[model samples]
Target: MTGQSLLLIDGFNLLSRAHFATSYNRTDDQLKNSKGMYTNALRVFYQKIFNLIRDHRITHLSVVWDVKRDETARRKKYPFYKATRFELPEPLIHQYETCKAASDAIGIHQISLSPYEADDLMGALSKKWSGGDCYIYSNDHDLFQLLSETTSQIIAGKQGEYVYSLSHFQADYGIAPEQWVDVKALLGDSSDNIPGCPGIGEKSALPLIQHYGSLERIYENIEQLEPGLSRLKKKLIQGKETALLSRELSQITCDIAELDPLLMDDLKVSIRKDVLGEWLEQMELKIRIDSYGA
Candidate 1:
């Protein structure tokens, strides 16, 4: 919570958001260089990361990306986890390597772990290395659970930036930041294919979590819950097993091994304009390269 600020970007989340935003734009052809690499997502990603560093006076930064879908541990735990999700477009997939190279060229620390998603890596990195103020750049509400006294998640949008600090979380969700996983467990996250107790929702689950502190405590004291809620009590009792499993699916793991020593050394933001210019030129991102020295 002291000294310099560390900014972590959820690389896949940001890139996907950018790619989709530009995909339907009829005027722009998703920016391509002479090599035919899809440059739209990478351009947006780099621009946004640079803007964040400059705007926030970031001293340390890292971009974490998700590995292959089939390799994720969550998928192993529940075969249906993100099973319904569509595959990323081939063009976007093609840009993944270039994006990593661009990040390195611009002197950004980048980490991609096999069998783990960016959220889990970001969680682990923030917990282990964020000795100062830490800001997570992503649009995923799932990352809200990572909020702490020194850590917050941000989304930059047309309407302005949305920051999920501990206070903002409390005001918006009526529960402590730490209770986010429990809330998600009760309502389920369709985006990630986690099915909460059938027909149960935030309205039904929030009050119980608020009163009992957790899903575990709520189940323990279910019998003592008010008598007027007989139907609700029955639903909770019936959905007990699923709710517990959902809780496990909702939580983000933070026990990842430390990043590579070389990447750790690269965490400081320092740009070599010439090296970056060569990368931008190869990628056909002349516009970005032209603006670099400006």
Candidate 2:
């Protein structure tokens, strides 16, 4: 444990949430000054996360991103995964690029790999981030598995009251934080279109897994489960390969090479006023300068 902490953002998850909330229609250079969806999103995200850093006494932080063009081939493994989501709007897209540049200019780190999702990157970094117990910044339940006695999760929210806690994750999910990924695989994730065991859900999977100990154990004695759940167990057997594969897919990488914290030692506590100003200018935001309290 490094004693120092890091705030890891699932970058696109936050970006997408901000983009739709404002019904934003972004354009290149439209957000050049940070008025664009991405800029505004980044500002709120940065401020909110930084505030948490201040609140929690965190000494280091970074945002993890999914740089792959199409979910890093997740679609290949689970073709319908995220197939229903809308395409990212142009302004929001541009802002993502600008946001990275802005965050970088301000000296914080932004980690991404082409074949991975932010969750994967976050997981990888969490395991190997060299910092003390890591705190992941998302409610992506998929991440719940990373929780521990000291590690935790923070649910980002628009109203500033996001849910957070490894303890909550464990209590709510009925297993230790380390078991969440496998638990999710057993239940399947609707948001990502993952095909978990058809009838198994958080309720059944958590307890069943808690009692049975492992998917293999559950499968080995499928006949002994409740009759209603027996049908679900069959489905689990049918999708056994997927149930297992999704677990693999959902497991965070914990080995990403780019998340080295020492690489972030140069980051300081102050926002770069010039970078913030330029970003705002690009967005055509007519902030009264003083409003920034600069």
* Top of the candidates by lDDT: 1
- Full-model lDDT for every candidate: 0.78, 0.66
**Tens digit of per-residue lDDT, candidate 1, span 206-226:** 777777788888877888875
Candidate 1 Cα errors over 4 Å, as ranges: 25-30, 227-230, 258-266, 286-294
lDDT of 2 by residue, 1-294 (tens): 455776677788777676565445754444434332435555555555556666666666767788654757576666677776667777678768867877787556677777778777777666655656567777576777666655677776667656467767656656666676778778777667677777676667777778777777787887787655665666676778878877776666766555555454642235566766675566554433333222
TM-score (all chains, Cα) for each model: 0.90, 0.79
